[model samples]
Target: MTKTVEFYFDLGSPTTYLAHTQLAKICADTQSELIYIPMLLGGVFKATGNASPAVIPAKGRYMFQDLDRFAKRYGVQLRFNPHFPINTLILMRAATGIQLHQPQRFAEFVDCLFRALWVEGRNLNDPQTIAAVLTENGFDPEEVLALSNDESVKAKLKENTEAAIKRGVFGAPSMFIGDQLFFGQDRLDFVEEALRQD
Candidate 1:
């Protein structure tokens, strides 16, 4: 049986976006299943008493530069958003909705929003901006917004965050090969190695 790689991520995290670009191919090559788990980064931080590396000025600058280097190494486009800290509650809720409802289109929605928030540097904080992005991508903006507000979707997202904290997750781009938890996009090599093991 193929091993499963559970990817716990939040859209507000650029590293999570970077990991997403590579994990699919990694799973394909390794005969593993990639499962996407959506959670709120802020909630995780609050639950674990962990803060973003970006909270420090020098570290934040260097982190972005490192992210760009990784993007180059991965041969993927990644432009840093000027709007640094985007509140992704609605976006994440929408992701949970897609995962629960339109499973077929989950990947597409993730790619679109990742590009919009990171590559294209769109201001997704604005509802109108989100609507435009959704409309431009041929998705019904109103429908998606409504779905994002669903009670079940909200609770699922909450559960994801709580479960991640319980699993010792303090940041985005966390991947699990069985119960081995790897944090950060840079740790993907170790994750691959874990998958190769019996």
Candidate 2:
């Protein structure tokens, strides 16, 4: 049986970047289909009474070191973008729009965006930067940007975020196998286990 897993993500999250970096292997091993669900983490947090890990004193302190260790262990480059906690609304909307228009292009664009933010310290909120990233990824930047602001695309982004909140998603990189929700990059092992059982 082919298992289907829903991946809820927001680009502002480092953990989401981490999960994106590692999920391909798990999907290959388990033969599970990944249903990409992009949502605004800010909306999820507001609706679910949740906050970022960086807001917690203890966890905030540990997260930096944890990210470093995880990066080294996974051999993934990790650059702390000066624009930490970036305004991801536009990015998420653009991504959703791209996915709606061109699925394959969406994946490539996302990979580039993630690397730009988490591996190269790029400012994702800037239009020029995002355009450069998309262009470098072989996407037509102007077309994607045009669709990004379309009413329908904007509506999808809003709907996705609202649905995520209603689904009890309070953070980034959350995976859902049916109704079982696994939060965090560390919880991906559990997500794989759930897929195995399925």
Candidate 3:
């Protein structure tokens, strides 16, 4: 039997970016399939009555410090974006569109956007900047912009967010191994253990 890990994420999240970088290897090592479910983190928070830790001054500071430690441990570099709180609506929509229509390019889209938002610290909120990034990544900015506006893609993103809330997802970087939900990049060890169990 093949195990599957459902990863619910948003590009706006640095922690989710960390999980994105790690989950593939974990799934490969465990002989599990990693499924990426793109859902708006803000939508998840609204549905779950939760707010980002960044809303809390002390927690926000501590979270960044802790994330730095994790990056070191994971051997991945993450420079917090100065332009955070980026409106990821279009970005997440682009992701949903890629996953739905261009499955093979799904990882590429994820990698590009994640690095743009988290690593390269690009100001993704600027339309021209986003378009340039997409074009530089070998994607047609206009085509993806069209897809982001597609009715099906918009609905799919909303549906995914609703389903995530129904499944008890309160935030991004939530992983489900079977019916067990693990929230946060910090809980990935538990996710790996869950995958190893079956």
Q: How much lDDT does each candidate structure score? A: 0.94, 0.87, 0.93
Error of 3 at 98 (Å): 0.8
Task: For residues 41-153, write the lDDT of model 3, one tens digit per residue.
Answer: 98988878998898899999999999999999999989999998888999999999999999999999899999988899999999999999999999999989999999999
Please, what are the lDDT tens digits per residue for candidate 1 over residues 21-66? 9999889888999999999999999888888889999999999999
Worst window of 10 by summed lDDT in candidate 2: 101-110
Output the better candidate (2/3) by lDDT. Answer: 3
Estimate, for each residue in 1-198, the C-alpha lDDT of model 2 and write its tens digit. Answer: 688789999888998999998888888899989888889899888888889888887998799789888889888999878888799888888899989988877788789889999998999888898888888878887888788888999899889888887887888888888898898888887988988883
Worst 10 residues of 3 by lDDT: 189-198
**Positional deviation of residue 69's Cα in model 3 after best superposition, in angstroms:** 0.3
Ranking the candidates on TM-score from highest down gives: 3, 1, 2
- Give the lDDT ranking, best first: 1, 3, 2
List TM-scores for all candidates, in order.
0.98, 0.94, 0.99
Indicate the residue-level lDDT of 28 in model 2: 85
Model 3, C-alpha of 130: deviation from truth (Å): 0.4
